[model samples]
Target: MSTGKVVLGTVAGLAVGGILGILFAPEKGSVTRQQILDKGNDYADDLKSKYNGIAETLKEKFQAVKNDAENIAQSGKAKFDEVKNEINRPAANY
Candidate 1:
């Protein structure tokens, strides 16, 4: 979530920065508009790539945590069964 927010903020910053920079440039109106459009598209692509990478990383981490929890639960269940069997064993006759 935080990574998504950061990417959003970055794209916003780039857009604002590009607009401001283009506004001050000496180019004609049509050329400036085109430049801004191109820049916006580039920034959009960058944001998409970054967000996808973050999503992949998060998925991997989540899977790892889930696997760890399952292993711990299995170990605990095995230990309980061993203790239970030991307690239920019959006593030897005299």
Candidate 2:
């Protein structure tokens, strides 16, 4: 499995376990609910961070690939122009 998937699964498992433990404990209901809510918020923040990082990385990679492609196209065009110029040059008189 992918690292993201693994991390998500682990986080989900831990969240569920925490909820179960809280339910079984003698703690007040309000505190347990608050803990669950806090954990959920934290998980959401983590996911947002992960997604943002991935998006930034993907954008960078796309820009790099686009730059390389443009360079190759420019080089090809230059070579074509050079060849065309050579072909069009006048031949020496007999």
Candidate 3:
């Protein structure tokens, strides 16, 4: 699977395990709730960080591809111009 999906699955598993563990702990209800809240925020932040990293990678890859395409187009145009100039030139005297 893709890296994004793997990261998302891992984060989700961690969040579920954390909440379950907290629920089974001997802490008071108020403390348990607080822990869950904190864990949720932490997981959210981690997910956001992973998402941003993936987005940046995709953007960089797209830019590289775009640059390659532009270079190829320019090269093609240059070749076409060279051929056109050759065709339009006068034949050399034998």
Which numbered prediction scores highest in lDDT against the true structure? 3
Model 3, TM vs. native: 0.89
Tens digits of lDDT, candidate 2, 1-94: 8987998898889878877877788878898788778877887898789889999999999999999999999999999999887777754322
Assess the local accuracy of residue 54 in candidate 2 as a C-alpha lDDT between 0 and 100.
90
Each model's TM-score, in the order given?
0.79, 0.81, 0.89
Minimal lDDT window, size 10, model 2: 85-94
Ranking by TM-score: 3, 2, 1
Can you list the residue pairs that collide in candidate 3?
Answer: none
Candidate 1 segments exceeding 4 Å error: 1-10, 91-94
- Given candidate 3, what's the lDDT at residue 75? 100
TM-score of 2: 0.81
Estimate the lDDT of model 1: 0.87
Off by over 4 Å in 2: 90-94
Order of candidate numbers by lDDT, starting with the best: 3, 1, 2
